[model samples]
Target: MPETSRPAHPLSADEALRFTASRATETTFFFDFDGVLSPVTDDPDASQPVPSVLGVLEELASRVARVAIVSARPVSFLRSRFGSLEHVDLYGLYGLEVWHDGDVVTEPAALPWVPAMAELAERAKAELPQGVYVEYKRLSVALHYRTVPHLGGEVERWGHEQAERVGLRIQGGRMVVELKPPVDQDKGMVISDAVLGAGCAWYFGDDMSDIKAFDALRAREAVDPAFFGVAVAVANPETGAEVSSAADLTLDSPEDVARFLADALPVLAR
Candidate 1:
């Protein structure tokens, strides 16, 4: 990432963002939860959204065609923090589960793997190192090594081995590795489908998986010259440089994300 973040494309940040704001009601905004809305922490369960982000997102949702969080987390985990924002949709576990219009809808294909994932969770807890944290989402399992960064290589090896053993898919992040059903769904597919009719879109994220979402935006721009897309990255010690390098612009932190939205509200409302 550059010392001062700038647009990787021809259009400047102000120019592209302003263009999107000008078409607020025809635009959709997608965000990642862990490091984009909430600060990354050693304890995954303790992670919470920045105090002001939810309020700003609620206000932004009111102005835009749609506001959605497309994250690696489960819908239940996302809802615990964002349920108050009625208009904001939730696409959790990378779109394997969705919460929209007061109902939770999970992908039919992913349901069959629930028991396998549950079994994998227990196996992980028993087999993995003591410092590693095993987070079990019904459709997936995350082996977190943030607290014990030194165990990353061991955890990753174990995770991949388990994934292979169970015929599941693997996703690697900052200091965590996850095993999920091989359903062919990801942030890219989620954003590609979600931005179908929107004139403009923006995706904010802070991990390796988010690069696919950035690619989706670029692909949309290639086909539709009229469609404007912005990819914003939130900085973190892990995965920050890589994600930022792929983004249109980089914000310093989740607090910066909150402030960015707050500042954009006026332009969007206009």
Candidate 2:
């Protein structure tokens, strides 16, 4: 059952700080890549983490018992993006793959579905509207219409049609449509696996896909009161309605997210 109670809001810097300090000892931070740690961009491949963002994450990772980057991108892609950021663990393909201790561990169950998903995406690229760009991530497929804003509806409709035709599930985000196998691989499952047996879990994201993680965290807390944490959503203009509604606290932007983390680490360390 969905947890009926909404998580508390972190409206101001003071409230956010107090929330963090209160759960400091139990918290384990999980960040989304595209718009949480790294800035979003027209060219997804060009999006990289700002220097200050990386520095703050490094510091947080050092202080926290667990710090992970959970992204929809493939594990290898994340590895390439953050080549030597050894401090943080990488949960890629939306928790389908985990890069830990210089090695990659993927859920064997998800491996066989990758090639089939890639092929489906390739077909989507050919069938979708002219400006709709298909991103083949092996484990998942994303149709981006941020470039062709006018065709957003068509992109979504076609994405859904294709997902249905291919027996996949549709996942929508900021100007993008995604198709993934009907598996239990989501940010929520990732957080549950990573933090369920641990002290606490805090997840930060800026898109609809992230709400799953927020829901998961809260549900876990409800079931196990000892598991305490926060759910932070980056408030971008493009943030989805569902994501905003599900978030416990909303920050102004990725810059604000980095600043919050930077400020909280020192206090949490104590």
Candidate 3:
């Protein structure tokens, strides 16, 4: 099969409806939190889902076999962000943690890597350029330069170096650099595990970390001819070129993603 290029824009409501209808029998939906459901902000702590997102997700979850959030944030952070919503399943730490049914299940071994990551973040703050900022997320460390665009390249290189030295992986996102343990648990792995052999799945995201999930879903579809799904990218200016190219569809922003989800649920549920 020939590889198709990624679309520059999201599917229209009609297109989404047709796509969903085609996979009505076995469809699951996975989402990313920041920039997919919530707007991206200078302060990550200030980011929150649009008022309607939770309601839309709740409705969509009732219709689909599963609704999971695969995010780069820690499971605890994700819980604090959207734990009140009963319908959504949370996959945090870039898939290292899973929260469901009011219970948090984690890969205990990954816990030990937290302090090491923090130390790396501290070193980045001290060594990187003046504009570079580090976010120590216990299980992950993010070097951010959104506030200082000129330092983006410097921060990115510093993050890569730190990851190499620590034997961790570098996950680049919008205006940020993340370091995490070298694990096979990526967004795609998390979605694949959550679906449990489901024939169809749709994943929406807005950053580089989401590319793994897109690749995983596409690979699964290739392996099983009956599998069908779409990888939707919410296009923010901050998103990397590689991430945009890897997506099947690209929406304008978090608002657009919410609109797409809201419109798709009713038809998909039928």
Q: Which is the winner by lDDT between candidate 1 and candidate 3?
A: 1
**Ranking of predictions according to lDDT:** 1, 2, 3
My TM-score estimates for the predictions, one after another, are 0.95, 0.89, 0.88
lDDT tens string, model 2, 133-218? 78888888888888899999888888788777777888888888888877878888888778866656778999888988898887
Which one wins by TM-score: 1 or 3? 1
lDDT of 2 at 182: 77
Alpha-carbon RMSD to native, per candidate: 4.3, 4.4, 4.4
Which 10-residue window in model 1 sums to the lowest lDDT? 1-10
Candidate 2: residue pairs that collide: none
lDDT for 109 in candidate 1 is 95
lDDT of 1 by residue, 33-135 (tens): 9999998988999999999998999999998899999999999999999978989999999999999999999999999999999999999999998999999
Model 3 clash count equals 0
Off by over 4 Å in 3: 1-16, 22-25, 129-131
Best-matching candidate per TM-score:
1
> Against the hidden true structure, what lDDT does model 1 obtain?
0.90
Residue 156, model 2, lDDT: 85
| lDDT of candidate 3 at residue 168, scale 0 to 100 | 91
lDDT of 1 at 225: 74
